[model samples]
Target: MGIVLNQSLKNTIITYLGFGIGAINTLYLYPFFLGTVFYALTNYILSWANIIMPLLAFGMQNTLVKFYTQYKTEEERSRFLSFTVLIPLLLCIPLVLIGLFFFEPISLYLSKENPVVKDYLWLIPFIGLSMAYFEIFYAWARVHMHSVFGNFVKEVGLRLFSLFALIGVYYEWISVVEFIYVTAIIYFLACIITMLYAFHIKKPVFQFSIPQNVKDVLVYTFFIILSGSVAVMLLDIDKIMLNQYIKIENIAYYSVATYIASVIAVPSRAMHQITYPITAKLMHENKHDELNDLYKKTSINLQVVGGFVMLCIFVNINQLYVMVPKEYSGGILVVFLIGISKYFDLILGNNNAIIFNSKYYRMVLFLGLLLVFLTVGLNMFFIPRFAITGTAVATLLSITLYSLAKLLFVVKRMHLYPFTHQTLYSLAITFGIFLSFYFWEFPFSPIISIGLKSALVTLLYVYINYKFVISIEINQALDLVLKKLKIRL
Candidate 1:
């Protein structure tokens, strides 16, 4: 908690702000205008960008976080940062060349539609290259203990830009196909902005210096590459698999459900951004007890926050889907499954942070690769038969298993746990609310039916939480607010 304890309120607010806008983009705009296939392709290509980006970055984002704190002086930090940036540039050439050489096979494998696949495949490396440096410079911000701007670019700026693009397509200002590629180009341009903004702040002096201890950095990079690749594989392989087995249109359906479900995971993503650098710093300082405590608190905090979100979405999923066309309703199930999978990740909290920042990370990386392999295999087995449902089931099972594996390792090896009374109560209350609405049925229009059900669900979940889940501090704060209002009889 100490590592990320500072400025958490601000970060949380920013995360919510980002999530609010992003929710509209995802839930309303995407489903309303894009249809299922395009919606899914949007998510798929973006994630695919991440899948290939790590390879291009040469795994230096992890390297930057790991090494940046070692330097005390600005000069030393600059040299290391420069070296980090330079090596990735040196690495990107090969990725471009390989991606060019392998474009058709990659496209054929990535999707069956393959309509604009050739046109879009070229954007992969460009987006990947941008991601490579975005991370490198973003790490620059993180190690400096600044999270707000990095998050602004990541969560706010890019999505806001896309919202305008989406509007452009809505008005036929740009063709949908062109807009798709344009969004990728926007990602690259945003990366440049992030890098430039980083320079504006750190203004790291890039002096020529010998790379520091090549052996250790390379060793770290090896494990991180495996870690990075496997992490991206798990996060993304579902849509990629969806493309291979199902129509690209199905990808759109899955994407909508995914967007709804994934909103619950945003807290973890934001928290992880700040927590990573702190974990790196903690491990270097050998503050085991502090690290363990922070890990537990983060898990509990995320569960409490993420549980509320998951409850909201899981309860009102029917209503939320009403905003979309009839065909995408199938994604509701996928939404539930994916939401649960992400919830498991939230419950585990900063286990990855603890592992990645620890000396024990390489072994964890090996275990992660195993999980990635299993996830791929399971998706292959299931997606052929169940389609979107199959993909959801595959993702849920694999992610839960992976989180459990990490949880057990951390408990066994470090003698730590992330659960307590609050965790139990939150889950119990959430489940009660979820099941409360599970039996409700209404004979009305989809819009009206959904709205009514969602309202009831929200009220019930809030009531349960206020009674059992919300903190004493929150209660006190509410009391203060009430007292200030001086309500009349």
Candidate 2:
């Protein structure tokens, strides 16, 4: 718990700093500097890459985390590491070949609705390849208990470079076309940096020999590919489908609203970095008691923090939208629906880690495949009628059903529940705070109104939680922060 606290706090700060820069890029720079058409193109290319990355990487990122600690000998671990790294290339090379042979037809299909996408179809595989390897190396670092550097490179480095790229576009140093190409270059560089850092953490010893559990490892990786694909598809497929059904520029509008809601998942992402490998280690050792404790603690702590973030977003969304361009202001409902879904996801805590590392992982693949089809079906039905709002509704439904299924599986199979009495209390507190402050706005500019309302919400929420002690872990964290600041609470 101590190590989890320390690393999660650091990762959270880094992630938010990255998100802060990303918010600027998403809201102000991309729309204003790049224009909506180019902005949407940028988003569309990346979302396409994300949707295909699991296949490109062959699920090695998660495979490394799940299997790395099980080996008893350094030689065996080296063999396993080498296997994870090189096996993906087997799939990647074939994919590139297929893309080369079928490029024309694929491009025509992708660009049927919007011809702008035809010229940039090549960037998807390029960026997806880079992203796939980046995760592979990042998993290498995570298993070594050194995740902060990888987290920084992942969360902040890429966004910071995008900021520079956008500025270059602003100064006319680069055309928007070149800016699009540079975005792919940024991902490639990030992958290289992470790979180098991973090496620095522990120099690799390449071995051609396979481990004894090769069959088990390959089977897990095979199923995990489906699970990983399903997860990424749920998040990014909406953006891809949007390009097909509507004008590409609307993606920018939808992107901004989704970015605001994504902040709610920050705490969960930060905590998952360290907690994932820890959960794997615990499961391997059959430490159910400690694992169960981690499950409940993570759920409550994440809900407490994530609930506060969701509250802030819901309360300040109207004011915040006032600051963005009027065209993007229509995504308010998208934010609400998506934000609630993300909060539900956060409250599940380490459920994913537990399931993916356990024997029940194959179950995820079956359920995930069903949801993937369901997601696509719902998007097809909803997007033509509702546009971006329909996409959000599809996402909300898919993720809610998916999370519910995973939660139920964990409860039935593992006999672990993330919810407790505090869960209800936390929900009550969030609803109360939202009701009290949402309509109470200051008579000022959008920025000032947001600040005033956010401060009041944070203070009242924290004070109430502190006074009542909603979560012991959160109370302890608050106490530690107050002590560090030399303030009496």
**Highest-TM-score candidate:** 2
TM-score of 1: 0.91
lDDT (Cα, tens digit) per residue for candidate 1, span 37-61:
6676677777788898777788888
Poorest lDDT segment (10 consecutive residues) of candidate 2: 86-95
Query: Local distance difference test, per candidate?
Result: 0.78, 0.94
Off by over 4 Å in 2: 484-486
Local lDDT at 364 for model 2: 77
Deviating ranges (above 4 Å) for candidate 1: 1-6, 108-113, 441-489
TM-scores for all candidates: the values are 0.91, 0.99
Error of 2 at 52 (Å): 0.8
Highest lDDT: give the candidate number: 2
Instruction: Give one digit per residue, the lDDT tens place, for model 2 in 1-489.
Output: 999999999999999999999999988999899999999999999999998999999999999999999998888898998998888987688779989999999899989999999999999999999999999999999999999999999899999999999999999999999999999999999999999999898899987777899999999999999899999999999999998899998899999999999999999999999999999999999999999999999999999999999998999999899878899988999999999999999999999999999999998789999999999999999999999999999999999999999999999999988998989999999999999988878999988888889999999999988888889978988898899999886
